[model samples]
Target: MEYCDGGSVVDLMEKRGFSTLRIGEAVAIILQVLEGLTYTHNAEIPNVRLADGSFAKGRGLIHRDLKPGNIFLANVGGKQVAKIGDYGLAKAFDQAGLSGQTMTGNVVGTPYFMPRQQVVNYKYTQPDVDVWAAAACLYVMITGYSPRNLQDQDPFLAVLQNDAVPVRDRTSAIPQPLATVIDRALIDNPDIYYKSAAEFKQALFNSIS
Candidate 1:
């Protein structure tokens, strides 16, 4: 793996004293992450070179864990670039069907960035879970707080019982169109929201452009 000398997004947040970043910085980071996710979600499974100089057909991958801590920054051509990291919880979908459990009865992921569906079943999670988490990361960067309240309640329970706090509710400084895009991405139901990173990225572009 290439080294990311600039550190993770969480490090940047901490360095800024947990204050929100400028709109441009936050959007730039998120756009980079979304681009990475677009590629990752559509990556070919079992993407390995065979001894006979052949390859096998495959399916998409689901990155079950995505948060500011997992997004690293690197200095590339004098510009800081955001890159997705830590795929310990990533799972590949089956070639036969998009739905298949990689494991059973396992709950893994940062509660602050996870959606309800991921909390319910991490093993059978889909790509949209990553999109939700990406939005959560953006939300934190813009609001200095997680989308869900994490104060006095059990984190896991809060994930299951609470809806994501609207981006504008945390701070009205966010433009309505941008807020709408981020808020929609954090919706608990992946089937109804951005089903892939490409979709989420397009929505973001449309909102800003």
Candidate 2:
């Protein structure tokens, strides 16, 4: 791991003397994270044979603990690149079952960013959970508050009890298109949720474009 001179996004917020970062800056950083996630969610792991002597295809990895504090900024060729770090809670979905560190039915993640489904089934959480956390990071970056207000409530129960507040509700300055993208990504329902990081990234791109 290389050193990041610009520090984490949390550090950036502190340096700015405000929790919320400029919308443009926050979007830029999150776009990079989405790009990283696009690759992570579609990674192909080789050399694993399937049931009938056939190698399995692509493998997807989920970073269950994605937050502003875990995203670090590094100077690369005069550009500040946002890199996803602290993959301690990362899980890969393949034919070999859960990875080494994964424990079935045990919840482990930052409550503020994770969706309710993740809390319910952390071991089997899919890539959309990471996408939701990414949106949560963006929410805090631009709105200066978490999607759900967890004050005076048990952190664990808060995740199961509350849905994310709409971005525009927290701050009306956000444009509807951007807010809609964030809101849709944060939806906990299975039927109408962003299924993958690429899906969320495309929605975000379309909103901006």
Over 4 Å off, model 1: 47-57, 95-103, 189-192
Using TM-score as the measure, the top candidate is 2
Task: Write candidate 2's Cα lDDT for 12-107 as tens digits.
Answer: 999989768988889889999999998988887554344454655548678899999999999999999999998777766555444536655668
Q: Model 2 — TM-score against the truth?
A: 0.90
Residue 57 CA error for candidate 2 (Å)?
9.2
Q: lDDT per prediction?
A: 0.83, 0.85
User: Residue-wise lDDT of candidate 1 within 1-209, one digit each (tens)?
Assistant: 99999899888988988778888799989999999998888887765323354645656667788998899999999999999998867776543222233335668788998898888866567788889899999999999989999789999999888888898999999999999999899888534388888899899988988
Please report how far candidate 1 places residue 157 from its true position, in Å. Answer: 1.6
Off by over 4 Å in 2: 46-58, 190-192
Question: Scored by Cα lDDT, where does model 1 land?
Answer: 0.83
Look at candidate 2 and tell me the lDDT of residue 51.
40
